[model samples]
Target: MKHYLLFAAGKDRPGIVAAISRILYRHGCNMADSTMTRIASEFAMLLIFQAPAGWRAERIGQELQRCEKRLGLFTGIKPLASSESRALKPKGRAHIISVYGADRPGIVYRVSRCLASKRINITHVSTHRTETSRAAGYVMLLEVELPSLRMAAGLNKSLGRLASGMGLHVSMRPVETAKL
Candidate 1:
């Protein structure tokens, strides 16, 4: 089996996923992982899948090109190296950080900088902006891997300082993982 990554983006509409998945299915591709989300007015996807060794990159590209034209999507596919196909094991405990504040610039950059300084690895991030009668509100959720429990106290303190300095609310908690 050979692994490949597919990226697709276009206007948000019904049948986008179905159209793309149909092409993969018809070509005997098995999806290993995928993320699809709508950001503002656009939809985006990242998919990792395995295909039969006989499925050449050129063949896959041609199929995707047809699908793109049919669906009016921008699509790209690339083969994954063996090393890149393997998922990265989390190096530490997982945690979720929540940030809420008035809509303003630099929120993401400032918060990410703090986490970077602590060597925390961010696994996922999602943010939303809401409008209230009084003001625009922003909410950012970050899934991160913490180096150790010992740093939790200090991390919280640091975040508290940032919250106060930036007039934002920040909170974090460990993620509960299910044991199989």
Candidate 2:
């Protein structure tokens, strides 16, 4: 089997998932991981799927083209290299980080870059623009993993300093992983 990634975005509406998943089903693709959400008025989805040999990206693209036209979604499909499929496992605890304050450019870039420098893997991130004025505010929630308890303390302090410098409020809450 080979892995592929698909991204689709359009105005939000009901049945978007149904329509897209139907096409994938017809194309013999197995959805391995996916994320779908509404950002403002737009609905966005990213799916990482696996399909049998000979199921090329071109085929999936062709299959989704019609769905995209019908659903008014801009879609893209690409093959995933083996290296991209193998992600690093978290060696420690999971934490949710929230960042918010007056909106400005580079918030995501700066914060994420800092986390990357620490080798903290960000599992998920969602951001929103809340205010629409001279002091517009933005909010971001990130799920991150701290590789060690010691790393957590330093990370918290660093994030605080970075947030203070940017005039943003940042908080980190540790999450308990469930063993089912």
lDDT for position 129 in model 1: 94
**Superposing every Cα of model 2 onto the true structure, what RMSD results?**
2.6
Query: What would the TM-score be for candidate 1 when compared with the true structure?
Result: 0.90
Q: What is the C-alpha RMSD of each candidate to the true structure, in Å?
A: 1.8, 2.6
- Per-residue lDDT for 83-146 in model 1, tens only? 8888898888999999999989999999999999999899999999999899999899999888
lDDT of each: 0.90, 0.87
Which pairs of residues have clashing backbones in candidate 2?
A: none
Report model 2's TM-score to 2 decimal places. 0.83
TM-score of each: 0.90, 0.83
Best by lDDT: 1
Error of 1 at 13 (Å): 1.8
- The count of backbone overlaps in candidate 2 is 0
